[model samples]
Target: MASATRAGHRWLKWVGFLCVLCAIAFAVVWYARNANGNEPALNTVAVSRGDIQNLVSATGVLEPSNYVDVGAQVSGQLELIHVRVGQPVSTGDLLAEIDPTVYVAKVDATRAQLKNQQAQLADRKAQLRLAEIQFQRQQNLWREDATTRESLQTSEASLASARAQLAMLEAQIEQTSSTLRAEEANLGYARIYAPMDGTVVSIEARQGQTLNASQTAPLLMRIANLSTMRVRAQVSEADVGKLQAGMRVYFTTLGDAEHKLYGELQYIEPTPEVTNNVVLYNALFTVDNQEGRLLPQMTAQVFFIQEEALDVLRVPVSAVARNQVKVLDAKGQPQIRAIETGISNRVYVEVRSGLNEGDQVVLANRDPRAGQGESRAAFRGMLR
Candidate 1:
């Protein structure tokens, strides 16, 4: 009985060992299948003909191409403002007026002084003529032996003195005339006129306000020619070197993003502005505003087109790495190909050479099947 029991126990142990081996085999097969399924493959995109533009973006403010701050040159009470803000004015049009009372009185006084000097000059000339006649008569009398030598000498001395007085009066008249002209100019300043054709954009002085222009000219108003607008774009110092005068640029205002206004780069300021340790330079461009749509101080999103390519072979920028691209050749094998690129817009890069429109380029390495396997493995882990 003992021998039979021992044999039966040994058979039961063998059966348990076989069951363990089966379980181990099943686990190995499951793991191998999942591991094989999780292997990744290369992802790719096709090269195609498309347009790409390389641009530098910046924010800027719009301003008038031509603007001026009209000021009062002479001090007086601001009597009238001929043009209101937003009013269109032509050159020489009256813009404002100061009280002409003081200027007119000054002009009158200067004119009177000038006239007095002229009358004095005429009197001096009359006296000079009389003296010359007396001197000549005295000389003739002396030659005829009718006058004494002393009398002739006295007459000559008197003539010389009269001539000197006349010369002095003439100089005085010239000085007075210059003063009169200056007073007249000041009188004209009381009536301020527009220096150019534009619209009044600002008014700094009000009627009845007293202006003291003894030191600095008092600002009265500002005029802006809205026919053309300029955008002052601040670009980073790093990008400023790429900008050049006459390069094509376009901008859109916050209010009118649908419409784009184009212009050429007019200038790039040599000096840079530093803000928070970052340097920026101002780039200027002008655009026509005939429709009066563009206004001063309007914020704009500016684009400087550095380069562009149209209907050229292009591919995903991600496909190009370090001036080379991983391309799938005719044999469907990945190979590195050196390529020349022209313009890139962050997403698409223009292929200048060494690539064809129908060729495929590897953008990234991705495996959709591996993702599924990972999901299944995660599920199995959660079940465990």
Candidate 2:
């Protein structure tokens, strides 16, 4: 009977021990849940000085700063194309030639007519000289009463006819000379020359191609100076108002995104281009292309800088909320403070005030010990 009582006492002791263990486990879980356990750890960043820019983005095309279309001023068959596409040329360089056979023949005909007019003028002058001499002789004879009045009168009429004939010949010679000059000019136009220093960008006329410049000058080729390039950026209507003349801008080519070519805004066209129901304005700028890297009609990714702050206090945009920021004190405790921001690039913002250099800005807060102390399943079960 004593042995049975001792077994019962041992059973009770085991039960009590199990109850105590259950109470201890419950207490631990309750403490873990109530002791700021669910709070997230603090993510922080240091306030530092950096560069920031407020920019407007747009697309553009590169074109030569100066360009001209070389055309045929007079009509003829294209005899030669002295330059190929991309050939370099200077002013007065012979670019090409039209078949000058017709022009040459016209010039020859005009020249021969001019010579004929000169011969006629010479013959008329000789006749006028003879008439004047005879009239003088008649006057002298009349004064001496050695010639009849009728004969003197006839001589005077002859002199006047000769003078009229000479004047007519002179007018005809002048008209012929003017015609000759025009024909000579046409002959010269058969040979085309570069009017400016540039590279031949295009050739519209080929060898032996017939060109008729009567109505419009036939486009023979195009020449452009590639030493400087102009960027024509298409700015959206919403952003075009923010742009102004003489502002700084830069661009990058699709093939070379890493390298930026910069320039100042030159002009903004008053007209807008309506494409696919989108209104876009043209903003122009020029960039020095001494390296000859830019080409005509190349695309550019452009940025127009509105405002910029250099070597200024800055922080990530996420760190600032509602013109206020949470900064960690020296003791690593977060405290909210009102802030003033200047320029923002959507990624980083300029910290105008309320944040000191090297100050820790708390992005957010969390419990650092939450993950370490409990398994995911245990924490979940405790919550349930």
Candidate 3:
């Protein structure tokens, strides 16, 4: 009976100890859950005053503002090329010369023909003068009854025929003079002259090359005014509507990306080019290149500034979700608030209202301690 009583006492003591442990475990789990639940889980950024710009980007090529293809007007062997590639030329400066031998020969032949016509005209005029003198003398003789009326009529006929012959020769001479002028002009075409002041950008015709101008004018060289450059930007069809003439724009070459060349949007081509079924429209803008740094056919990264806000309260674009922001209030509590935004680029957004400078906006929820600690606490509570 004594052993039974002691065994019952020991079992009761063990049960009481287990009950105390259970209470301690429950208290720890409750504290963990309550403490971690009160903590915020988020990363934040401050809204600050800065400049923001909305820009459209596209790739383009640099082209001369004014350029021309110099070609040969007459067919002959290209004998001399006076200007080389990259040489600067002035107006009326000799650019090249085709073989003038054929053209010169044609001019000489025309001149000879004109001279022959003029000589024939001079002879016809002399004969006309003689016919007039004879007609007058025969009339005097007929009045004195010293010559027959038939002789007088013959003199008059001779005079009229001589005048007609002289008129015909004069007409022939005038026609030959015109032909001579045309042949001389063709001879001048043999010597190519610079039509404008520019730099020679290309030379297509080589010395000793034969040119055929019968069908089309054979290109000899290319001249361009490099003082100004036009950027031909290929903008996507989606962004074409936002662009217009005189819009603010700038560009940078691949070689010098840090330095930008500024200009206004000058034109947008009405036609769109389709490549691989992707439509693209061309936009042009001009930039002054008085220093001659810009060149033809250079690749440019163009930026069209659509809208800009200066010294405005802005936040990272990622912080705003659907025009709503999660921000930490003055009491350090997270609150969801609607915000009014103006212009935005890919990286930042301009906050027009509902957010102040130095305010903290949440980007994401990130709490390392809450994840593991809360999970363990929940598991412990389940066990209890």
Which one is best on TM-score? 2
Worst lDDT 10-window in candidate 1:
364-373
In model 1, the runs with Cα more than 4 Å from the true position are 1-50, 318-342, 351-365, 371-384
Model 3 scores a C-alpha lDDT of 0.91
TM-scores, each model vs. reference: 0.79, 0.84, 0.79
Q: Give candidate 2's TM-score.
A: 0.84
Q: lDDT of all the models against the reference? A: 0.90, 0.90, 0.91
C-alpha RMSD between model 1 and the true structure: 6.9
Model 3: how far residue 117 lies from native, Å: 2.4
The residue-by-residue lDDT of candidate 2 on 144-211, one tens digit each, is: 99999999999999999999999998998899899989989999999999999999999988899999
- Model 3's number of clashes is 0
What clash pairs does model 3 have? none
Per-residue lDDT over 218-323 for candidate 1, one digit per residue giving the tens place of the 0 to 100 score? 9999999999989999999888888999899999999879898899998998998999999999999899999998889999999999988889999998898888
